[model samples]
Target: MSGWTWADVDVAVPRPGSGLPGVAMAGFRQRVRGDVEIAMVAHPSVTLFLDLSETGGIVREAGGTSRRGSFVAGLLPGRLRTGGQEGSGLQIRLSPAVASVVLGAAAELTGTVATLEEVWGRDAGRLEERLRDAPTWDERFTIATDVLARRLAVPSRVEPEVAQAWRRTQAARGRLRIDGLAEEVGWSRQRLWSRFRAQLGLTPKRAAQLVRFDHAAHLLAAGHPPAAVAGRSGYADQSHLHRQARAITGLTPAALATAPWLAIDTVAWLAAPRT
Candidate 1:
């Protein structure tokens, strides 16, 4: 076995035509000769991490709790960290809208980390076993996608209006007003606020902020200046962007620009075809 490095890790994604809407899957494997640690930033999606390693599997910590091996991380899992002596897994990112239907408890998962068994019970173990026995990353992706597709076939509990609101928010890059979303969705402000929070685990305003911050973080990672990123990301100004960045990631703009976590996005996410 060789030392672990992001560059040496094998990364795999599903075939382009096989994708489910609002869902993305990636498979990773590497030999670890020493300890490994990664600071994971918050993203807008609910994430499922399946650790397939037979020994020294990944351990995740957030919100004063720790989970080892496979787990589910909801949106805005603040200041999350993962460390271990082994690294091999399938990671699935599900949009909150789809997560509501698939996980069937997206609201309960908000801002927290829960074991896969806690979410899926015995099924979690079965899925992990199947993935571990797979001969290739491609096979694992196929298996994972098949399982997700089956789960998605169940009737969605999320209202169409709420899903539409989320779509509009993403399309606008969080620049639109919550009241406007309510109006577009044919619901009153109060109604929309309550329902959206109940289903997605965050208020509309916070969702917008997360989306905007995500945009700014990527731009910062892309070598843009903080002022330019803030303006481009719809922030009131650089100061506002700084505050939001600190609140979400606990890092200044300059420091965030070079974060190894965001840096990995270029290779593990952006480089892969969406599926």
Candidate 2:
């Protein structure tokens, strides 16, 4: 079981259809006969996991810190990992734009993985208990989305200008110039950088690059060549794409294209079919 990966598990992605805005939740539950360690590759969104395991809870290791309970992972997690025996949980992804409220502040979670208790306080346990007691996966999804919707209803969204800039960055797949975005948003470069980082837990440049890599990674997974992906993903060339792939995932572009972390996303998100 040391070779465990998302490909080996049965993932259930019951959709909420239209209720959840800017939030995605996927439920994963499976048992490995023996010990297993899984490498969780980085992604572009803030992630939260709700644990309901009857046995061992999931453990996560990132950077120099590690935790073994229900948790939230910030953007650009560098080589996070966890596994063993068997486990069950709900994984939720939140766009940084709406995360500021649903999560209290994305900046607080940036680049780090923390126990849900740390981020959600007393409410974390309550949520977990409620989810655990639920009779069905659909119920958990409903409970989880309802919780986030309640938080979002309280107001305190990101600035409209900053949100627009982020949307543009995603639309361009990180190819747009920082200064250009600042000009269009009417904020100085310095101001944009500060506010963006403070609210999203990532600088504009980093966010753009993350979005770019996400697009390219999926392209590669869909069987596109690196050279072609580089051309369309806004990189200078193939070599540039290779370096970014290594920097972000510690894997060459080819290997990252088939990486299991990304493969499962295809199944769970299912917005795009495999080519």
Best by TM-score: 1
Q: Least accurate stretch of 10 residues (summed lDDT) in model 1?
A: 266-275
lDDT of 2 at 78: 77
What is the number of residue pairs that collide in model 2?
Answer: 0
Which lDDT tens digits does candidate 2 get at residues 217-243? 989988899999999988999999999
Candidate 2 achieves a global lDDT of 0.80
Task: Give a tens-digit lDDT track for model 1, residues 89-162.
Answer: 88888999888877889999998888988999999999999999999888888888888889989988789888
Query: In each prediction, how many residue pairs overlap at the backbone (N, C-alpha, C within less than 3 A)?
Result: 0, 0
Report the Cα lDDT for candidate 1. Answer: 0.84
Superposed Cα deviation of residue 143, candidate 2 (Å):
0.4
